[model samples]
Target: MAISKKNKSKVSVDGKEYLWWVFDEYDQTEFDGIQIKAVSSDQTHFIKYGLQQSLNNSKLVLALKNYTKLVHLSLPPKFENNEGVITKTGINRMIKWCKKDVHHIEYALDGSRNDLTEAEKQLLLKELQKIIR
Candidate 1:
């Protein structure tokens, strides 16, 4: 939380809007993404959410759940990388960090190193956003 980058943005879900802050811990490395702090439009209170992984849509879901008093966390679809981001030897360690999500959105499973396209990423985000509402 000692980090000083004050990134903020507005997000709309279920016809309602919210404000969020992105900050990383002082000890956290650049590879680790920042945590999200968000609050509703009314500003009654705030929520600090950290999911311990990368992926924009998933992180957004974490924020929406913490910001509201309702049960939104269970709605966001969980995801996992079929083939590990690391080498075979380090695969298990990375998978452990993925937090037991499903691999519905397959990546690198077909023995190809192709990166995700912008359109594909947007489509996935759209699918995830659908559950947020």
Candidate 2:
């Protein structure tokens, strides 16, 4: 993994504190050392979004489980666009590429495009704020 620019800081917002860092992968090496924690699940979602944006590789597509290990891959445009006959068989293939023991995270194994819930949007906003700052 190549870190093009590194920014590490502590951000406090609305009486909450967070750790923020940015990375850039100039090389193809795997990026696996990112660590973040939050006081609540909502904050976790925000931190994740901020971290992901800093490591901007348009081809970067990660399927995470339980907020721990992430299965990173260079998914084709087909997958990103949610096209193709995403069947049980196809999902099985995708699952094969998953990290075992990562549990209880939201996954569209069937390759469906489901809208984020209100709670998810709020968490995403928190994440966006971290990046904008």
Candidate 3:
């Protein structure tokens, strides 16, 4: 006669918090005690991993300095002054620091975007690399 054994329960690694993350989605990602970095509530950010600028812009700034030659793209004129309100927008524009730049790809994809000489694909690759490093 064979003795019946009890069914084994599934085990989760690093308990339920850390390991359980991969299968789930997070709205905000924390770093250095701050939730400043946002983790998309989707799979792409989870599946594809690396340094996202939302986590740290300094890293990308350093990468631009290292990989590309010296080039100063000035902040948009509208943002040149008025200190608090305009300066951030100006800086963000020059670096394409966040979604603002990426959002344009959608608009331009429809053919309304001017400045056709600068190809969208090329800009996408270049910006993606900057984000990666």
Candidate 4:
């Protein structure tokens, strides 16, 4: 499905502009969470993130906290904008994650079958800290 242009917002990351939009899959039973989609202004790079619902908490507090860590690494929580539009930091993080071939984080708090390994997570975290600053 094509995302309407009116629904997309603009953000620039690393001097490159990107168009981003949030796809709320309310009827989706598998993940039961929103999907953030973005593409570079030049249409060269595309990235998507599935922010799945946490199995441990229905309120999404724990899920979001963990997701923030997984998605943004050590970056502050302010980088995430939950109110429909995505923050610039969030876009940058998504691009970084995409380049690493990392996508969504499962809701398993036990770290079972996650997308990123412990070492990989640490590496990405360090890289994010260095670049995002």
**All candidates: CA RMSD (Å):** 15.9, 15.9, 17.5, 9.0
Model 4 lowest lDDT segment of ten: 57-66
Query: Which parts of model 1 are misplaced by more than 4 Å?
Result: 1-6, 26-33, 53-133
Order of quality (lDDT): 4, 1, 2, 3
Residue 72, model 1: Cα distance from true site in angstroms: 12
lDDT of 1 by residue, 28-129 (tens): 521244454555565543433443454544422222232322111222222223441222223222222222333233221111323655455444434433
Assess every candidate by TM-score.
0.31, 0.24, 0.21, 0.42
Local lDDT at 107 for model 1: 24
Who is ahead in TM-score, 1 or 2?
1
**Quick one: ranking by TM-score, best first?**
4, 1, 2, 3
Per-residue lDDT for 61 in model 2?
27
Model 2 off-target regions past 4 Å? 1-7, 26-46, 49-65, 68-133
Point out the higher-scoring one by lDDT: 1 or 2.
Answer: 1
Q: Per-model C-alpha lDDT, please? A: 0.37, 0.31, 0.25, 0.48
- What's the residue-level lDDT of 63 in candidate 1? 22
Residue 120 error, candidate 1, Å: 42
Local accuracy of candidate 3 as per-residue lDDT tens digits, 14-117 = 22111001112355321122111112222111111122223222221112212232111112223223442323234333233332333222111112333433
CA lDDT for candidate 1: 0.37
